[model samples]
Target chain A: MKPNNPLKKEKIWRVAAVLFWLAAWQGGAMLLNDSLLLVPPARVLQRFFALVREKSFYSAVLFSLARNAGGFALGLAAGVLLAALAARARPVEYLLRPLMVAVKSIPVASFIILALVWLSGRRVSVFIVFLMVAPIVYGNLLAGIKSESVQLREMGEMYRVPWPDRVLYIELPQLKPHLMSALSLSLGLSWKSGVAAEIIGVPRGSMGYALYQAKLYLDTPSLYAWTLTVVLLSVLFERFVLWTVKRAYARLERL
Target chain B: MTRLIDICKAFDGKPVLEHVTLSLAPGVTCLMGVSGRGKTTLLRILTGLETPDSGTVEDRPGRIAVQFQEDRLVESLTVGRNLQLALGRAYDAGKAESCLASLGLPGCLQLTVSTLSGGMKRRVSLARALLYPAPLLVLDEPFQGLDADTRGAAIAAVRRGAEGRAALVVTHEAKDCELLGGRLITL
Candidate 1:
């Protein structure tokens, strides 16, 4: 009785496409009839539901969630502060240019391995997340700072709007889009690179450890399950962070 | 109470202002000059927004309100906040409300500057300068984008609000000077 939604129809078509590819995967698995090579989508979903019931699974998810989220939050703060400092000071900008370039250019895997040596196994994911995110956040915030219109600044100066007012009325509005973009981008990268670090390091009670165990035991379904959960969690975290940022912007607009 | 003695300015060693000495008094003085002349340069030098290479300016006060050539309102903020930023917290809402009322922007106080028209933004900027507590008022073509009646009203309001303070009105139109009932300073 409900009218068909055009956007929902498009989404349904996308889901159908995913199902088609999944059918191909199942057909390929059947042809091989090999448990080691692959597992059906149905089995993966079933195993995912079962895995959710396990307390260790929750702990592993919680551990990774905390580390990566903590790292992201820390990087966000550090990036904004540093970018502001750098924007104001030519010397700081010069010093950080090479460092930001290095972070941006260096392979995520290389950082994971190097960070494994520099940081504790428990802290590897957090370190990796920070390394990945700091450069991204810095780049975005710096661009925002640089792109601020000169005329507006002149206006503020002429008005003699107090320092706090200048920051709130001018700088904050200019920085919002960059801040929002940095948050969304850094979150996704942090989760991906953070888990990748955990997988290589195999830290105890971490999501990466569970993935490693699943791989070692040839439990393909559990591996897929963890992968799915990580993707879902990453998306949810990004949405939540962006929502918080939007709410903050709304409050600022009101002010 | 302001004086500029033999002001000369150059950019890239090419002279923009040549031995320009001008003294400013209270009320509007419509600045007139041909294109590429130094009318804006003279205003900028007087406001201390720019320094002249060979001038000794004296007797200036702490506060000067300016309506720049470009209406420099915060695009994200409301029309009211733009004026508030200039006027400071010492400003009362009632006065701001009435000032905006005079400018025909009373109903648009809640609307953001981004949504305002070009003429509206100019009016807001003009209103801001009028409301600011200042010893001097400098206007750079403040009537750039207003209708005839609004322009007349704007001129009246500025003259009424200036209250014998030093007001320097810059305009290409001689009639604009006549309207403000002030002396003319032509570059």
Candidate 2:
């Protein structure tokens, strides 16, 4: 007989692992014997279905999603622009070094609290998310730009390759892995920091606010449901963004 | 008539090229040397990528086509796109295809450089140099990885490409100079 497909086997193993975890969670919840302390996975799923039927749930999801996405876009643009400037000029890199270090080292909770004091609750999540994302992108891309091959650059110079062509053909290919890494790292952090800021700020009509309400009422099932919703949304957003970028790279390679 | 007069270059106080004077005319000139003989440094100086510690370069061409020792190709891109990147508006698909075919890389325009074998990538790099329109051509170890027959074919192609232009080629083999029917300059 022919060997089994590795990809299919891997998929089956992954599914089995997930089922095993669910069973463990169910067992742990039963042993606890307190719904408030540990709601079972089945109850949480039921609660999630019921919560999804509410119009307020959609509003909350949309509100959090928009703020996180906006903050991520702003961070991405600023990081790329700063990285380009830093790559071109040594002084710019030095000037940004301290700021980037500070941003990377500072605590997310501290930034969220500072943002809350400076801005309204409605805007805190966006600010926090931006702060979380910019430094990661800037640092990774700067390294990528610095690591571009000297030999290839000399080849471009010798041939008098135009500025646009040099960037498209030489620089972009070298930077793709760095760019993807920055995106993957910053995207997950954006969601985490964005939701943390929202919960602290307790912005109305947001997932964070819904989570806070669930906590305030000591409703374990509702809290689990909202948490699951945020995770699903985050995962879907990451997949979509990564897929779009990969497709664009594929198109460029074809060209 | 490009000339290097009394050129001297050193790295960390060790001399690489000292008081080297040479002239390049409109024909193929094959440069032969052992390893660590500063052949690449001379090419770099001629191409203005490195400024000699002491020398005067006269009438250097503003544009030159160079094939560096390494196949400095964009690994993610297709062969045609690499040619297009270097040649810009001067790129002709028909000319490029035929040039690649002549270099023994037929039907390789659509293949990504990363997928190609070492010899194939070398030819692709050579094809880029040949296709680029310039007054001077500089190739460093252009026939490094080719077999004997392929090397002969590549030599013929390089000679044809060097017509009406100055070609500076660095190679280890004295036979390459005889094959190209060019003057020999040893560093």
Candidates' C-alpha lDDT: 0.86, 0.93
Error of 2 at B70 (Å): 0.7
* DockQ each: 0.70, 0.91
Q: Please report how far candidate 2 places residue B115 from its true position, in Å.
A: 1.6
Candidate 2, clashing residue pairs?
A: none
Candidate 2 structure quality by residue, lDDT tens digits, B33-139? 89998999999999899999999889999989999999999999999999999998999999999999898888989999999999999989998998889999999
After superposing candidate 2 on the true structure, give the runs of residues whose Cα lies further than 4 Å from its correct spot: A1-3
Candidate 1: residue pairs that collide: none
> Which ten contiguous residues of candidate 1 chain B have the minimum total lDDT?
B82-91
On TM-score, the candidate that comes out on top is 2
Give fnat of each prediction, in order.
Answer: 0.66, 1.00
The DockQ leader among the candidates is 2
Q: What's the true lDDT of residue B34 in model 2?
A: 92
